[model samples]
Target: MSSNIRIIRICQQCGNEFEARKTTSKTCSDNCAKKAYKARQRSTNVQTSAEQTLQIKLKPIEDIKAQEFLTVNESAMLIRISRRSLYRLNERGELPFVKLNRRTVIRRSDIDRLFDRPAELMEKSRPEPVALADCYTMKEIREKYDISEKALYELIHRHEIPKQYSSIYAYVPKYRIDQLLSNPSNLS
Candidate 1:
């Protein structure tokens, strides 16, 4: 009878038991090593996917915080207006803004207030005190005179109306509008 022997080996790649022909064998075979490599790659892919999802979930919170206090550029983007137009409004005292160092800042609340009503309605809703004051918001101007935006701007451009700066809006002094209205020649 011929003598028989068996050798057991542990696959270096997968840690599974297998038969090996050589005492020096480490992996079960090249196939097992490749399978183990593929499994590791799959595990890495899952981990990367989970990390990506986590990042995506946190983006909105970060965006909100970023917008909480905004620079001129951010404010312009939020309002869907150009920076140049915003600057014009600032110069004309039509928008509320704060100056910090060399930068111009706008409050999120003020921007929110801008969209709260039609310009006409807002102009009309101001308290009598505000109406009589030196400055008013665009909305207030629209409401008080019952005029279109184009007409208001035309009045401002023609010096037919005098304006003052408040924290918001080019304030059309009620006195000036009254003076102009009293003089029908001022109407274009």
Candidate 2:
């Protein structure tokens, strides 16, 4: 019978030098091998997590099919308007829509009709332009200046900007807005 020869090796997990009975022994003990296996599994999980994150970041937009209806949020995103505005328009019955199993959806054709009006039809429906002396509402001013409601109110209270009562709502004079734009120092 041939004599068994032992091999000297270093443990891959614990970094300890030991005599291995088998040539394929990677760790000094079973405990070290289990720990090494767990570490490898943890590293694999981390790599998969990073890969999933990258996939989400590079995800493509879904294609819109013909004759497909869209949800309120989807319609809002497509039309570049806020969800609240879309909801308001739907509630006012200005936009054609349908309810399906408690979900409200607008037809793609209806949205297309809103923007795809004929030039003659649009000209016929357009209202007359307002005079320059007409004051603008606080909402209009906020949108025009891109300022917060609080800031606009503060400016109005400080007398830096002037406003007039229009029966129901207070309106800021257009001349004051023009003055502010002409002299930017008045904003502070």
lDDT of each: 0.67, 0.70
Per-residue C-alpha lDDT of model 2 across residues 14-119, encoded as one tens digit per residue:
8999889788999999999999999999999999999987874454325443437987766776777998778645533347568799898899888877778888
lDDT of 1 by residue, 10-119 (tens): 89787889887777776798888788788889999999999987775454544744665677766766666898888776544456677689777887877776677798
Query: Candidate 1: what lDDT?
Result: 0.67
Q: TM per model?
A: 0.33, 0.35
Candidate 2 wrong stretches, greater than 4 Å: 62-188
Q: Give the least accurate 10-residue stretch of model 2, judged by summed lDDT.
A: 58-67
Clashing pairs in 1: 119-139, 123-139, 123-140, 135-171, 136-171
